[model samples]
Target: MVTPVRVVIALCLFVPFVAMLWVGSYAKTDPAFIGIPFFYWYQMAWVLISTALTMIAYQLWRRDQRGRSSRKGGVAE
Candidate 1:
């Protein structure tokens, strides 16, 4: 049941978790951005990035579901 599209969707969902959970990668106060410390700015940036990635994963999931439904002769996109 695994497809390339599903793999891509999994990647889209996994990246944000890996990025945020790996705190050492962003646990710094240097590289401040317009007064925002790296620690804070990095998290804020990931918030937006995570939102986008989640949206993409959701869309891909919908597409995958529709494909499966159609293959089963059910309602599809």
Candidate 2:
């Protein structure tokens, strides 16, 4: 059970990073965002989103850990 939770957390952390790389690698050249290129802006936006997702994952991981501990003690209510 805990192993699955850990794996999910790892995937959540990694998938966004891969997505960022993919977006960066295939972005166009023109249509700059306020002078910044599409390649640059897209990566920057993903960086912010990734930070948010990481924070959310961390919170969920902490909650899962707490639940596991409480369940072990039969006090999870």
Candidate 3:
């Protein structure tokens, strides 16, 4: 259970970072978005997504920690 959760959290944390890197490699002038280049908007969008993903990862980690603490309590008595 914890392993799967950890994998999911790791993916959530890493995917956006990889996307930002991929978008950064593209040319800015070829395709534009609302007068801004693809490079700029893509990175900006990923920044927002990254924040959300990070929040999700934090929540998952907290949940995992809580579960561990509860299990410990069960074993102690």
Top candidate (TM-score): 1
- Residue 31 lDDT (model 3): 77
Residue pairs clashing, model 3: none
TM-scores, all candidates, are 0.91, 0.71, 0.79
Model 3 CA deviation exceeding 4 Å by range: 23-25, 74-77
Candidate 2 regions with alpha-carbon error over 4 angstroms: 2-8, 23-25, 74-77
Report RMSD (Å) for each prediction in the order shown: 1.9, 3.9, 3.6
lDDT of each: 0.93, 0.79, 0.81
- Write the candidate numbers in order of decreasing TM-score: 1, 3, 2
**Candidate 2 residue lDDT tens string, 6-64:** 88788779978788768657478677889998878877888888888798789878888
Give the top-scoring candidate (lDDT). 1
Candidate with the larger lDDT of 1 and 3: 1
| Winner on lDDT (2 vs 3) | 3
Predicted candidate 1 versus true structure: per-residue lDDT over 1-77, tens digit per residue: 78999899999989999999999999999999999999999999999999999999999999888879988998865
